[model samples]
Target chain A: MRIKAIQWALSAAVLAMSASAFSAPPTPAMLSNACAGCHGTHGESAGPSMPALAGQSKISIVESMKGFKSGERPSTVMGRLSKGYSDAEFEAMGEFFSRQKPFTTSQTLDRAKVAKGAELHEKNCARCHVENGKEIKDNSPVMAGQWVKYLEIQMADYHSGKRKMFDRKAERMKPLSQSDLDAIAHFYASVK
Target chain B: MTIDRRSFLKMTAGAGAAGVLYGCASTGPSGSTADVMPKTGRRVVVVGGGYGGTIAAKYIRMMDKNIEVVLVERNDHFVSCPFSNLYIGGLMKDLSPLTIRYDKLAANHGIKLLQAEVTGVDAASRTVVTSKGTLKYDHLVLSPGIDFRTEEVKGYDIATTPEVIPHAWKAGPQTVLLRKQLEAMPDGGNVVLSIPLAPFRCPPGPYERTSMIAMFLKQHKPKSKIIVLDANPDIVSKKGLFLKGWKKHYEGIVDYRPAKKVTEVDARSKTVLVEGLEDVRGAVVNLIPPQRAGQIAVAAGLVGADKNWCPVNPTTFESTIHKGIHVIGDACVAGAMPKSGYSANSEAKACATNIVNMMNGREIVDFSGINTCYSFLSAKEAVEVTGVYKVDKEKNTIIAVPGTVGVSPDLSELEAIYAESWLKNILIEMST
Candidate 1:
C-alpha cells in the first residue's frame, strides 16, 4: 500500500518535473530497465536458459550482486552489470525483485522423472537445496520453480568444470549423469 | 551447425519459444492448435521487430493484458545495428551475443512472433498482408528503420555489383565484408571512408567507426592510414572531442577532410571522386550512402510533408500522414532527437503508452524521452552526448530540453567502460 502511495506521489511529482531542469527520478522498474531485455521484466525471465530473479530471497539477490561486483563470483553478463549499480541500488533492486510475484512458465511434468529427481536431490543435494523451496543459507536462492533448462545447464556446466564457485559443489555434482541432471531440474520445477 | 541463414534465424530465435508457439510459424491459426488467437480480442500488428517495434509489442502487453500483439519481422534473429562498429574495429570478436531471437517475448508476454515479410497493407480496413496471410488490427505500428538511397550515388545501387564498396551501416553481411577487407589490406595501403549528409542514423556513428578502424589498424597494420571524407562541414556530434581525438592519438595515421562529397565510384578501379578534390583511391572504401525511410514504411503511405521520412506527432509518435498508423525509430523525423538506437528505444515507450491510452479512450498524456550516445575516441578513451526532450505543441515536434543538453568535457577511460556497459544494458532491455 505504501508502494502504491509512493508511485502516485512520483507520478504527481513528474507532472511538475518537466518545469524544472532535472526530470523526476526513475522508478525502481524504470531503474531496472537495463535488465529487461535479457533478465525478463521485474526479474521473471521467460528464457529457460537464464534464471529468473523474481521472488528470490532479498539476501540472495543482494549477496549475489555484491559478489559479482567484487569479482568474488564470476559471470559473463552479470559481472559487468553489477559494476554499473551502487551498493544501495543493489539493495533496492533486491527488495524490488523480491516484492514481485514470480511468473514461471509451467511445463508438462513427467511424474516418473520428477520422483527419480526428488530421490536423488534428497540423498545428495538436500543439505544446500532444502525441501519446500526455502534455503537455510542467505546466499543460496530457492531452487523451486526455476526454469528447468537453466537448472539442467547449470548442473552440467558445474560438473563439466565450466562454471565453478565451490570445490565442494563440484565434488557432490561430479557423479551425476545427463538423466540425473534432467530429473533433478524437473524435481525442483514440480515443487510448489 | 550449418543451418542456412533463414533456418538458423528460425531455430535460434525460437530457442525458448519452441515449447509454446513454435508451431505457429509453419501455418496460420487454422492449421495448428498452438496458433490459437481469440477472434474477440483487440489485436496489434507490429511490422518490423527492431528496437521500436519490439518495445511497442512488449509494452502493449504489459500495460493492457487483454490486447493481442503480433510482431512481423523478416529475420528470425535480431542483429543490433548498435555496437557493430566494435566488431569492425577488432575490439570484439563474436557476433553471437548481438543476435537475439523472439523466444522470450512469445513465452513471457504472449506476443505472437511471426517470421515473414509484410507484403502489403489495406489501411482503410486495418489489414496487414504478410507472406503467410492477413491480420486485422486495432492499431498498426511501423518501425521498418532506414534504407540507403543507392541511386543517389552515380556508381552504386546495391544491385548488379558493389562488392568493392561496402556501406557496413545496416549491421549484417556488410559489417563482416568491411572487416575482412580491412584485415586483408596491406599495411601501406590507403583506406577511405565516406560520410553521408546529416540526419543519418547515429550522427556520431561515422566518427566512431573511423576511430575504431584506426585503433584496429594501429595494432595490426600500423603503417596504414585512414582518410575520412565528410559530406557535412564538421563533426555532427561531439565535435570538439572527435577533433581532439584525431589530432592527439591518430595524428600521423588519420586524415580528416570536411565538406567533401562522394560524386562517383569506380569499384573496379578502387576510386571515389570527392567534391573539390582529386579522385580518392583506396584499397577499402566504406561508403555510407544517403538514407530514407525503409521500403515498408514508404509502401504503407506513412511518409508525410518530409518526402524522404515519416512525420509523426512528437508526443504520441502517431503518423500525421495516416491515422491509426504510428512510426518510430530511425524512420520517423523526430524534431530534435537523432536517429539512434537510444532514440528509437525512448520513442517506443512513448508510442506504446499513447497507443494503450488511445485504445482505452483515456486522455493522452504529454511526453517525450531521453537519449545518451557514447563515442569511443580510441580503444580505451571515450566521450558521450546526452539530451532530454519534450513536446512543443505549437510546432508539433519534440525538441531537446535546452539546459539539460550535456557532453563530456574530456576523454576518459571510465567513459569507455561505461560505453561498453551501455551496449550490454541496451541489448538486455531490447531482448534476452
Candidate 2:
C-alpha cells in the first residue's frame, strides 16, 4: 500500500511537469478548423452580412476576439464562436490570415468622380487604410476597388435606422456629408 | 516581453510554495510537522469557490488543522469579480493571471478540490450529491453565487448566453464568447448593454463594464458607440468616479442613455427592444438581466415567497428556512451590505470563526467588521468604499456604523498603480 501511494504521487508530479512543458500554441490547421464555420473557408467570409476577414491585422483580430469573449466586445455571433477556443488558437488564426494574400477590392466606380474622390479618400481614410486604400494586406478594410453601391449604402446606413453595426473604430464615418461619401466611394472603387 | 520558462515557474509557484513553507518552517519544531497533520478530519463541504466559499474553506483549515474541507466547484478556476472591468479594456491580457488553479488549495492547504457541479443537497440525510459522488458533511457552507432569472426578459434564456449578448456575470465560456462577438463586428456597429435594477451582485459592475467597452470602441472602432439602457434611475456605487472616467476618457466616444429598461430581446433579428425607447439594432448585445440565488437555494426551500432572496440569522448566517443549511454570499438577505465579494468574504470569516468556536466550547464574537468593495474604473485606476456595519436592535437590519468608512482619493497615476497592485495581491489571497 505504501509503495503504491509513492508511485501515485510520482505520477501526479510527472503530469504536472508535462503540463508546464510543451505549451507551444495550437497549430494553424486547428485554428482553421475552429474558425472556418463563421469566418468561412480561407477566412474569406461567406456573405456580406458577415464582415470580410480575408486580410485583417493579426493583433487586431486576436484582440477583437479576446474582447468579445471577455465582455470588452459583446456580440452573439462572435461570442458563440469564440467560446471553447484557447488563446493559442486565436494567435494561430490571426497569423494564418495575416500571411495569406489579400483579396482584390472589387472595381465599381465612374471615371468622372474618381479624381475628386481621390483627394477626399487620401485626407479622411488614409490614417487607417494605407497603401492606396488596399490596407497593406491585413489592417483595415480594402476600400480600393470595393463596390461603390455597397460603400454608399453602408455610409448612409450609419445614421439611418436601416443599418446598425457597432465597431466603434468605424464611427468616424458616421458624420460624413453626402459629398464626402461620394468622393470616398469613387476614389476607393478606382483602386486596382 | 518574452517570458522564459524559469521566470514563469518562479512567478506561478511563489504563492503556493510560500504558504506551505511558512506553515511548516516558520513555527517551532512542535508547530512544524505536528501542525501539518489534520486534527479534526471532520467533513466540511463547501459548494462555491467564489469570495465566500474559497475564503471559508481556507480559513477553516487555517484555524483548525483537523477540519476536512471539500470544495465542489463547477469551474476549473476562479476569476475575480473585482477587476473584471479592466479586462474589457486592452489594459490586461490573458485572464489566466486573474484566475487561480484549484490545485493550489489541495496541494498547499490540504483541501479536497472537486471540479464537479452539485445537483442536489439532501439536507435531511446530510448528503450532497454531485455529478461525481455523494459527499457527506457535518456542516455545509453554500455560496454557489447568483444565477440570472432569464425568464424575466422575453426571448432571452441560457442558450442566448453564448449566441447573442453574453451576460458574462459568471466567467469562463461566456467571457470567451463575448470577446469573439466584439471581434467579428463592423467598426460602426451598435453595442447595447442593459443594467438591471439594484440589489444585484456587484452593484457598480455594469457601469464599469460599459465604460471599458466604450474605451475599446474609442480607440479601435472610433465610429462605433455604446448605448447603456439602465433600469435604475441613478447609478449605484462609485457613480461619481465612473462618470468622471467616462466623460474624461470616453467623452464624444460613446452615448450614455439612461433609465431605458430592456423589455425584450429578439435574438433572431439581433435586436434588443427597450420599453419607452427606440428599438435598438445591436450588432452585439449584453443583456445583464435580473438575478436570483442559485437553484440549490430555492430547491432547499430557503428563499421566501417574495421571490427576492433567502433570509438568514444576522448573528450566525444560519438559514431561517432550513436548520442545517447555512446561506452566505448573494443568496441570503444580507441587510445594508451590498452583495459584493468583500462582504461575502467578511461574512464567511465570521461564520467560520463562530462555527469553530461552537465546536471548541467557546463563545462566538457578535461584533461586526468592515465591508469594502473596490471597483476598477480604467485598467490602472480604482475607486473603493468601505462600510462598518452593525445590526440594529429595534429595526432588525444591518445599518452602517456611522463614520467608519473611507474612499480612495481622486484618480491619479499613483492611484492607478495602487489599484493594480491591490488587485493582484487580493486575487492571490482569495484564490490560494
Candidate 3:
C-alpha cells in the first residue's frame, strides 16, 4: 500500500508538470464545475451525505482519484466517474479544491457523542490525523468540519472491507464499534 | 398591423429561404410593438429558464462578468420534473420546495430576467422575438426543453384537455392534477400509464413513476393496480434493478406490458387503445406522448434531418445549422447521454465555458461531463445509474466513456439519501 501510494504521488507530480507545459489547458473552474451537480459550487457540498471537496489536501484528493480509477477503492459512483478524467485533470482539480476555504457543515451534532468522540480520536486516530484532524497534512484528508454522515459511511466502508485503508489505520479501526465510530465522526464534525 | 396565422407562416418560410441574402441587417418580422431590450457590450440571450438556461446564464457571468446575460423564460417559477413523481405518489408534501424562483439567480449573477414567451428566432438577423419585445444578441442560446407530439396519439389532445388525461411530464399543475386523480381513484381501480418510445425525456422516468404510484397504491388502495404500457420491447434503463424492485415491493400491484404501444385514447372513457392488443381502461390515464425539440428551437431551424432534436457541435453546444446559437438540455441530440436534469446541468457548464472561451479568442477545450440519475423503488430505497461522457471529435457528438458508465449493483437506503443530496446540491448550483 505504501509503495503504491509513493508511485501515485510520483506520477501525479509528473502529470502536474506536464499539464503546466500546455499553452492553455482548461481552467480549473471549467474542469471542476462538472462536479458541481453533486459536490456543490467550488466543491463545498450542500448535502450532508456528500463530502465537501473544498480545502482538501492536494495529495489526498489526487490519491483518492487514482484509487477510484484503479479499482483499488470501492465506491458507489466514483469508480465509474474517476475513470473519465485523466491524471492531469485530477492534479488540476486537486489544486483547485485545495485553494478554497474548507466547508463546515451546518447540521446539528450530538454534544454527548462529540465529547466522547474527542477522547476516542485522541486514543485511536490522533497519531495520523494530528491536531484533532484540523491541520491538513501531505497525505491526510481534512477531517475537521466534515459531514458526520459522510464520515460515518466512510468508516463503515473501511470496516466492511469495501474500501481499503493503510495497515496501521486499519489496525486502529479494528477495535472500534459502530457507536464508537459514530462518536468519532461527531467529534470530527464538531471541530469547526 | 395584425397578420393572420396563414400569412405569418408564409412570411416566415419566405424569410427562411432568403435568410442568407437578408443577413443581420434586416429585422425579419415585427412581433410585439414593445421596445426592444437595449444591448450593451457582448451579450448572450438565453431562452428558457430551466436547468440548462439558468446554469448557462449564471456560469457565463461567473466566467466573465463583462459579458451581459439575459435569461428569457415563460414562467416566473421553475418546477423541476426530477422529483415530481414523489409528489404524485404522495411522498412529497407540496411543490413549494421543488419550485425555485429566479430572483436569486438574477440578483446573485446580475442576469437580466425577461418573463416572456418566445415567438420566433431569426437566425440570420441575430434576434429573438418574444411576446414582450425583441432582443438582439451577439450569441443566442436556446434551451427550451421538449414539446409533445400529441397528434401522433390519435383522439388524445393534451393541449385541450390536460386535466382529463394528464401527461404530467413538465410537472407543476399537471403533477397536481395527476395526484388528485390517483387519490380519487377507487380501491380496485386501474391506473394506465402509456410511455412513449426511447429518446424521450428521462428514460427511466416512466418506470420510476410506476414504482412511486405503486407505492401509493400498495398503501392506500391495496387492490388497485397500475398498468404500464411501454412502447419499447423492454425497460430502457436500469432494467434489472427496476424489475427486481417491482418484484420485491410491488408484486401483483404493477402490471407491466412491454411493447404495448398506444394507438389512441378515449378521454371520456379513460381507455387506451394499444396496437396489436385489447384496450386498457383506467380511472386515471397518463399518456406521455412522442416529443420533439421545443417550439423555439424548431422555429429557429436548429433540428436536423430527424426533425425531433437539435444537432450541435458537442464541444460548444453551438447549433450545427445556425452559427452563434447554441442549444442544450433535452432539446439537443446528446449522443448516449440520457435526457435528465443532471445531464442538462453538466452540459450547461461545458457550454458556458466554451462560450466564454470563444468570446475571448481562447482555445475551446473538448467537452466532458457526468450524469447521475437516481430512481426511488420505494420511499426509502433507490437505485442509480451514472455515466461520464466525452465528445467524440469524429462523430461530433458526446459518447459515454467505455468504463465510466454503470448502474448500481443493488438498491439501498443509502443511495436514496444520496439521491436527495444530489437534488439539493444541484438546485443550489443552478438557482444560487
Error of 1 at B283 (Å): 0.2
- In the predicted model 3, the residue pairs found to clash are none
Ranking by lDDT: 3, 1, 2
Model 2, range B1-432, lDDT digits (tens) per residue?
323334422432463432211111222322211212122435678888887887678767766777788888888878876666666666667577678777776677888887776766656545565555446666788887788778777778676444667887876656666667766779999788888877798887888788788877887788888888888887876777778888878887556677777877887777777773568878888888888888777665667776768887664566766554667888878787789876777667656654454444334345253455656666566666666555554554556656444455554443454345445434554555
Error of 1 at B93 (Å): 1.2
TM-score of chain B of each: 0.89, 0.86, 0.93
TM-scores for every candidate against the unseen true structure = 0.67, 0.61, 0.91
Native interface contacts kept by each candidate, as a fraction: 0.03, 0.00, 0.54
* Each prediction's whole-model lDDT (CA): 0.73, 0.64, 0.85
Which one wins on lDDT?
Answer: 3
RMSD of 1: 13.3
Residue A70 displacement (Å), model 2: 42
Residue B327 shift from truth in candidate 3, angstroms: 0.3
Q: Quote the lDDT for A4 in model 3.
A: 38
- Candidate 2 stretches greater than 4 Å from native: A1-192, B1-41
| Local accuracy of candidate 2 as per-residue lDDT tens digits, A1-192 | 465356445533432332113122324633442243224334544323233456656876787677656755543234434543558867877778767665443444666678877776676666667877776434355555555654665566554534444555346666667877887777776777
Better of 1 and 2 by DockQ: 1
Candidate 1: lDDT of B272?
85
